[model samples]
Target: MDILLFLIIIFIASILQTSTGFGFSILATPFLLLLFEPMEAIQINLLLSLVISAVLIKKLLKDVDTGILKRFVMGSVIGLPIGMMTFLFIDLNLLKLGISVIILVLTLLLVMRFRMKQYKKRDFVVGGLSGSLTTSIGMPGPPILLYFSGTDTKKEILRSTTLAYYLFIYSISLVVQLIFAGTSKTVWVSSGIALPLVLIGLYVGQKLFVRINQTTFRIFTYIILLFTGLYLLLESL
Candidate 1:
């Protein structure tokens, strides 16, 4: 039963991640916590998410916004250490509860068509938030996704650039996590087991991406954000 659940979770999360470029950690980490220790679950999420990003990045290079990607990387350097500190010292349940509320509120605002103008400074801010979230919860997608949605970014650019940024964030977070929080063999072994599922998801997701129109893509994003927020809220409580 446990193996079945693990497979199901990895398969579905990989599809979401591959299709959206931002769902693996958001969808997987919380559930992985049910099956492993928090650190193990988080490390597994970071490792697999890094794999997905690495695999898809080369193909999406044309769509990347180099300026924005640079700023995100710069800001994340600062936020990564802060996140590691939080992971080391804070109570995770409280952090989850807070983040859940924030995600829920922001998602609602986004659904209401709240939009923001994108600026260079805001890019750095979003990156910082994403980086902090990455190490603390093994989820970095929320801030970036919400920010891009607010700015009404094109799907191709959003998908490509975020995946590019994730390639950096996930790698750094995994290293930070291992150094500060430590790791177990189960984290690596489980990630290795899920590799094939991730590959399958990569193929299917690329196919689905080409078929999804902008309106439908936005709807899918909203649904994912809302679901993530609700799930975390319930789990934290």
Candidate 2:
């Protein structure tokens, strides 16, 4: 029964990630938390995210906006350690509620169509904030990146850029977890099972995104985020 739920959630989350380049962690982590401890869930999710992002990197390398990726990644690098430190101090319930709030606010922005739609100046801000929040909250923040990119090019540029960002962040997290948490074996085993699901999910999401128009996609996006926010909010209690 648990495995079934894991597979189902991974499929949906991965598809969401494949098409939009964000939300896999946000959507999947909360579901995973229902079964696993928050720390374990995040570690495995990060590992799976790293693997999936690696698989997609080659295809999206040329498409990636290096300028945007670099600044975002650099900003993330600076903030990640701070977030990790802070995360260590916070209780699981608080973590869940905080992430729920972030998802709620972002969902509202998406529903109201308040994205900046510009990549240069706004991307730097978005990238920095996403980096910090992703590290702290485990959301990975592609929706924030999507809004900052402010163009339909999110399927391409933002997707590729976010893939790169996760690869980096998760790599760091893996090492940190091994050193700090000592749950590497458990996290690795679960991630091995989840990895294939992630790939399959992306394939499905890619197909969905390709077939749908932007407005239609955004509607789906908002609905999913609202649900994710509510899910986290409920789980936090």
Candidate 3:
């Protein structure tokens, strides 16, 4: 049953991630926890995310603006190490609740029509915070990117740039985890199982991207985030 459920989640996560450049792990983590230890789930998800991102790296290569990726990755480089260190002392459930609340409030603000241009250097700031949250709580970082860049730059530049940045951050964090987190072999093994699911999700999401209208996308994002926020808040207790 757990395996059955994980299969379903992988597809959904990939779709969300591919479509919005985020939400894969945020959607996957709670479900994964039912079958994996928190540390193990993070390890597995990070590995799988790295793999999936790498596969898409070439396609997005030309789209990525190295100038932007540099600052974002630089910010992440600083943030992830600190996050990894902080993870040692924190109760993960508390962290999840905090992130959920933050994202929830942010979603409401998004619904209220907050312009992305209003936040200067926002991607850099979000990348840092997202790196920290990813380390501590396993949330996907690109929504942080989504929130930062305006729709005008979203597809042509921001998404690829964000991917380049997230790649480095997740990789760096993965190395730190391998050395210090002491996740078990099962986590490494499960990542292999999860990879295919990620690919399928990515494929489907890529296919759907061109077809989704803006209004529909906005409505969907709002709905998913509301549910995500509620899920975390409810589980936190």
Candidate 4:
């Protein structure tokens, strides 16, 4: 039964990651915690998310906003170590509760059609938040997703740029996790087992991406954010 759940989670999260460029970590890490130790779940999420980003990034290069991507990378460099420290010393449950509240509030604002203008500095801030989240909880999508959604970014640009940024964040976060938190064979082995599913998702998700209209895409994003926030809130409590 655990095996089945693992496969189901990997398959669904992979598809979501592939289609949306931001769902795998948000959807997978929390569920994986139910099956593995916290560090193990986080490591596995980082590894799998890295794979998805690496695979999709090349094709989406044209859509990437290089200027924003550069700023994100710069900001993430600062955030990565901070996140590692949090993972080492902070109480994860408390961290989850805080993150859940933030996600919920931002998601609600987006739902109300709140808009924000994109600025250079805000790009760095979003990147820093995403980077910190990555190492701390193996979930980096929330801040970036919410920010982009608030700015009313085009789906193609949002998906492509975030995936590009993820390629950097996930790689650094994985190394940070291994060094600071340690890992077990279970993390690597499970990640290997899920690789095939991720590939399958990559294929199917690309197909679905072309079919989803902008309105449907925003609706889907809202649902995912709300679900993630609520789930974390409940789990933390």
RMSD of each: 1.0, 2.7, 2.4, 0.9
lDDT of 3 by residue, 7-56 (tens): 88878988877776555666787788778887888887788777767877
TM per candidate comes to 0.97, 0.85, 0.87, 0.98
In the predicted model 4, the residue pairs found to clash are: none
Q: Choose 1 or 2, whichever is better by lDDT.
A: 1
Model 1 residue runs over 4 Å out of place are none
Ranking by TM-score: 4, 1, 3, 2
When summed lDDT is taken over every stretch of 10 residues in candidate 2, the lowest stretch is 142-151
Q: Positional deviation of 142 in candidate 2, in angstroms? A: 5.7
In the range 135-155, model 1's lDDT, one tens digit per residue, is 988899999999999999999
As a whole number from 0 to 100, the lDDT of residue 174 in candidate 2 is 66
Kindly list the per-residue Cα lDDT of model 4 for residues 52-126, writing each as its tens digit: 999999999999999989999998998898888898899978988998999999999999999999999999998
lDDT score at residue 166, model 4, on the 0-100 scale: 92
- Which scores greater on lDDT, model 2 or model 4? 4
Off by over 4 Å in 4: none
Residue pairs with clashing backbones, model 3: none
> What C-alpha lDDT, on a 0 to 100 scale, does residue 196 get in candidate 2?
78
